[model samples]
Target: MKALVELANKAREVSGVRIYKRNVEAVLSAVLKSGDFWEIVDMSSLPVPAASGIVKVLIDEGILFIDDEENIKLTQKGFDFVRELGIETFEDHSCKACEGRGIPFYANIELYREFLQLTKDRPKAIRDYDQGSVTPETTISRVLFMDSRGDLRNKDIIVLGAEDDLTGLAIALTRKAKSVLVIDIDKRLIDFDNQIFKELGIDNARAMVWDLRNPLPEDILGNFDVFVSDPPETLPAFRAFIGRGIATLREEGGVGYFGLTLRDSSVFRWRDFQISLTSEFGVAITDIVQNFNHYITWDYHSETKAAELAPVKREPKTIWYKSAWYRIEALPGFKRWNEPISDDVFYLDEEGSTT
Candidate 1:
């Protein structure tokens, strides 16, 4: 498929988004699986920007087209090409009960109801921070999952590095931990969490405004029993968030939770990333739940490259962003990093599109 590789390369240049021949193949297969633009976006397992770029290039090659109903369609030639490539769409076997997160915490009815009400006016995610909030159900599930995994329930200390979804708020509401500390670059989130803590007299919880790209504050370092974050998937960003989380651990056996996504990282990239987490930081990966954390589209999504590069002009009517949640435990003699990351490439990377 040298010809297809060249086409994906051409599309990459035109769109200034990253994609591989596999992405081109994925676009065509996504179209075959579903005709709707948004559904194809979800099916491709690639960000809208990269998927859009590949789809446009395929259309130019007469491999794909928009039907009269505005649905994505493959030409006869496209079908033959797919068959030659041995690409086939299959049924989704992920659990429908918990959306494949494997944790049905939503069944806990009361926590969902309480968290939904508390976060009704939390904060709108801003593009400036590359921010998007997870659903209230996801937040509650995260907390409950922690409890199930023996990380919560009177856990003396917990930390969240760079939070906007207010998982810290949900943790505080549970009253299961003695203290919860939230650190983020955004003062807006810190103020919101702090305000909620004060109003409810949640003395065990507090928020701080500190960019993790800089050195982590000394007092909190090596002081937490657990850490949770949903940082950007870029390597530097991961180190900035997860590395700081590691530094906060009081000792070995301290656990951490973070999110990674296929949209922004290839499985090969994930391999190297997991290597860094385990080797460089001396932590053991405990769990990786695919599509565990679902994200709501930001209001500014229309202003993103994903919208700009989409082959279709239709707006999305569904939440199409998700990430795998990772749980790591500090191994014996775990390394700690409190060093400043002066590099500015903390958020955006070639493989990362939606941000």
Candidate 2:
């Protein structure tokens, strides 16, 4: 999972201390094996106990944590510290700056550290880019809950997808909500969520793996104040969630946000989808934010592993993200199907045409 690798790389980057090779190996091995806790044991298999003792030193220094069960847990502070190491240039662990083997390897420690802090303490899932598609709706849902604003605090928010959508939000909203109800289709994801909740001591959030297509149980009706989500973009499930989300809202104060990652083929389709929402649910476009698609070129690429590494060559990649924000408000006037042209989306003509 790209997100997991990113998280692990983040942990190492921020640690501030130059980890001995054995300790580094142990910590990474533990992080990959233990999903939530960095707990790695089997002291008998590791290099001498003196090397293991280094982990304790790291723990004492707050770089790592050993829990009651001897599981290693990285503190937010520790996690953040390691992640502070900037984007590193991979060169087979050879000192890039000094070309020496004995010294702490010089790499992009600071950048890595910041990225880790950005992702830490949030519910995040990683996947290969090709494995799943992210819709604008999904991205919007993520931004609504995770963005710097405190809009959802103390509000009852219901999420449509549990695994990727609300994992981070649940952790965040616990500080702000009276409660969060998450519904999903994956039982295993729910189990992972519970573990995270337990680790963070977040008590106001509960998750259940349930498909969004089926009719919700009676107990779930009219229970949420804000219904926000990025449902599976192509499925009827997305529409179903929208209908049910509005039904669950308390009244005129209810709010909903959707994420839809528009693909090359779906851009026109998305416009049609928007119109459908307006006609069917009286939802209006409230906010739209566009992100300049940017790529992160690191010091190392995948092919460089083991076969004599080199200083990473950086390249730029660009991707575009457009987010539309809407609210459930009564239509005030005649519905004009014409989209208001924004500079970010298109170039408009004096004749009122968009390019």
Candidate 3:
């Protein structure tokens, strides 16, 4: 029965439902504890937007019941299943937002820690200091974000302009993805990534110096299952990076992950960017996780400016910047943006002003 529950959880994780398996399991355990076999459990307690769908999945699998009031109840099969798994009492041990995992709402703690250990000595954030790099926590969180979306195993992932190598290292260490390729303009970043890959004996991962200002390399065009980027928040820069990412993806069902922030970009900017992605690029915005990329202050920024800012005056002592993560999926036969990168794509003048 424990194996059966594990199997069910695995299936749910790989399913297109986009909700964590632990969330569904937690809901079930809660229902069993309520002792209301005839009463429907209120769906609001679950964290996922598709909570009703999860309940329906349980019902479809003969593990739950839905009364006329739309409340949830455990079936006899469900009770037996939980009992066999040794869930004698329902205790919510998971995190409230991420369920129990430390990363997203329900991260696998072991996996998260492994990611941190692997990327602990990642290349320092110096060359691209204006677009500050994320902390180890944020990097692992990105991996968790992808895991939550069922986008990791056997997937070919490309990171446009990988600065700190956190995401690339995390994916490679998983050893599940078919391939991990990072393209960046900075030779330093690329070299650092390759050295890490070599040191870790990660054969499936590689980094190359390919500027997004140019077209994606012909050998890898339209060959990836996922593309990840933390583009410059400006309109032109964002479009350029996202355009290159889309161009590298498989024609259909390809996933793109990127980060945007409210500090620099306004609602109107978000709307335009989203519309361009969906309408012109042929991808639908599926999910947006708020404050997903928390960044640490690095040495490049002027200390005078930091002191004048607010709250924290010292460098590396505070984490005041963050970006919201965006997950978009490609529709069948989606058109990829193939425009030439504009000259202003590397603009960082706004970086200091915004920070």
Check candidate 1 and list the clashing pairs.
none
lDDT of 3 by residue, 43-154 (tens): 1132121233455466667877766653456778888877776654465444556422245622566767776665666666763424468866677777877877888888
Tell me the TM-score of each prediction against the true structure. Answer: 0.91, 0.45, 0.65
Worst 10 residues of 2 by lDDT: 346-355
True-structure lDDT of candidate 1: 0.81
- Put down candidate 1 lDDT per residue, 172-201, tens digits, no spaces: 888889789888878988998899899999
Winner on lDDT between 1 and 2 is 1
Model 2 residue runs over 4 Å out of place are 1-150, 166-174, 292-355
Ranking by lDDT: 1, 3, 2
RMSD of each: 2.4, 20.9, 16.1
* Minimal lDDT window, size 10, model 3: 38-47
The residue-level lDDT of candidate 3 at 60 comes to: 67
Candidate 2 per-residue C-alpha lDDT over 1-355 given as tens digits, one digit per residue, 9 for 90 to 100: 1233433344344432222344444444454344222113221122112223444445556666656654555677656655663312112333344222121212323423432443355333332111122332233234333323344667776776534533334334336666777776666556666665676677887778776556677677666666665543443434565666666665554666654433111344456667766776666655443221111222232332211111112211221222233344324331212222222212111111101
lDDT of each: 0.81, 0.42, 0.65
